[model samples]
Target: MKPKTYFLCTVVFLASVAADASLSLAFDKAKLDTFLTTNACKYCDLSEADLSGRELRGADLENAKLGSVKLSGADLSALPMEKRTKRTNLESANLRGADLTNANLANAAASGAYLREADLTGADLSGADLSSANLKDANLTDAKLDGAKLDGAKFCGTVMPDGSKNDEGCAP
Candidate 1:
């Protein structure tokens, strides 16, 4: 092979390896399994984990520390009645600044979660418990919140589920 062609090939190979290494460092199947089987992950750190676009239907993640976790476009929706073992748990998890756009989060237990500035546009949050969650400036445009608990939940500058903007939680 020509020297120039060999150098180009080597650079491309190095780049691909770097990409793969980064992805592998972000995802851990063992940790995921632990959360699935235990139903409890209090203070479990999953920061910067790339879980985007994953199908996590019926996953129980109650009290798991998911700070800065990338769950954008992921499916955390409820399963059918027959297939459901329990509701998904995300209660009190540090979901601050997470991207959940177009994600399905129906019936999730997310009370007291730190959802500040999270993107929830077009996401389904029907029947989810969001009581006392800090949802300040979170986008919920075209999102579904039918029967969801929003009492004491901060909504300042938040986009409502019906596409309306709210400033009730915004500071004066």
Candidate 2:
């Protein structure tokens, strides 16, 4: 092979390796398993996990790293107050770019969660405590947000449930 061709091949190989390594580090398998089995995985790395269609009711995911996670159609709602272990706690969790389309977040305590750019289309967020959550650029089209508490929540460039665009906190 020509010297130039060899060097280019080496660089491409290295770049592919680096990309694979980064993908492997995206999430912890043990942590994802624990969360799936027990519905609780606080303070763990679950970024980029494909948890679609999982029953995650009342999950305790406080401070979890869920960036780019795929939780479409997952249930994140709390049980009846008497039988509940706790509300779905996404407080301070990093859920940026997460795909939560059609997920059930009713009665969840998601205060301070980072949901920027998350797709919440058709999600049931009724009664959720989203106080202080960062929802900039998020899509909530057709989502049911009845009774949801949005005190201090950021809505820059967010798509509202009623099909309206919200730039309430966006910079001019």
Best by TM-score: 2
Cα deviation at 31, candidate 1, in Å, is 3.3
The worst-scoring run of ten residues by lDDT in candidate 1 lies at: 34-43
What would the per-residue lDDT of candidate 2 be over residues 131-153, giving only the tens digit for each residue? 99999999999998899999999
How far out, in Å, is residue 87 in model 1? 0.7
lDDT of 2: 0.92
lDDT of 1 by residue, 1-172 (tens): 9999999999999999999987665536677667657544556766667778987776666666676678888878765676555566787887877888888898887889888878888889998889999998889989999999989998788988777889987778
Local accuracy by lDDT, each model: 0.79, 0.92
What is the lDDT for 158 in model 2? 98
